[model samples]
Target: MTAHVQQLHRVNNLCAGLEWVADCPNRLARKALLQLIGEEVGFVLEGVICASEQKIPGGRPPA
Candidate 1:
């Protein structure tokens, strides 16, 4: 999220946004924000985000 959106309809939207940040392409700012989301990632996404540090490829996690 480069810029903030003002109108979020539901609380779940925030949660969904976190999932998007987790699974979507790499963004240093987003990753930084993701760390503040708490420790439920392993239980919630089943390692979808926690399994590795890369999402797109050809970067750090490729090794």
Candidate 2:
């Protein structure tokens, strides 16, 4: 649970940063912005995969 929570926190922070960058005019070129978004999406997916793979306490499945 701790690991899952930590990964989610990281993902959340990345999303916040992305939002801030996107809101800024001329912060990134169109291609660069798309690339950054794609990379962030990969990070989010990785977090989800990590969370799903985590073992729950007492051998119980995740809620």
Candidate 3:
């Protein structure tokens, strides 16, 4: 649980950094940073979606 919390904290920090970079004046740098942020956010969201899809196995098997 500690590790999970730490991971979420790191992701939050990442987003904060990405927000700061959004105003970068260098066009190429801005483009690269935005692309990286997009990929990382997508990866994190994919994991979250997969975790939420897990079943609790409450129902009995169908006959």
Candidate 4:
């Protein structure tokens, strides 16, 4: 598989795992989720905030 496809799979798996523990309030779990998504996809939600500051017109950030 291509690198992009593999990364997508990893992100999907992370989401599935999080769904299994939907009621937990553990900081570590949340942190891990963000880390996994970032590592696989190149940006977390927090990264989006930083990216918006760049002011790149017509740039749609990755999902």
The best candidate by TM-score is 3
Q: Candidate 4's residue-wise lDDT over 1-58, tens digit each?
A: 2544555566667677666556558878877766665564454433544456445677
Misplaced by over 4 Å in model 4 are: 25-63
Cα-based TM-score, every candidate: 0.29, 0.51, 0.65, 0.38
Better of 1 and 4 by TM-score: 4
RMSD of 2: 5.1
Q: Which stretches of candidate 1 lie over 4 Å from their true place?
A: 1-9, 33-63
lDDT tens digits by residue: candidate 1, 1-63: 111122222234556778777775668867776775434433444333333435446535532
Candidate 3 per-residue lDDT, tens place, 2-59, comes to: 5445656767877998868888999899999988987887777655545444433653
lDDT of each: 0.49, 0.68, 0.70, 0.58
| Residue range 1-63, candidate 2, lDDT tens digits | 676677678767777677666766774574587578679768777767756756545543445
Best by lDDT: 3
Please list all clashing residue pairs in model 3, or write none if there are none.
none
Model 4 pairs in collision:
none
Clashing pairs in 2: none
Candidate 2 lDDT (Cα, 0 to 1): 0.68
Error of 3 at 49 (Å): 1.5
TM match of model 4 to true structure: 0.38
Error of 2 at 29 (Å): 4.1
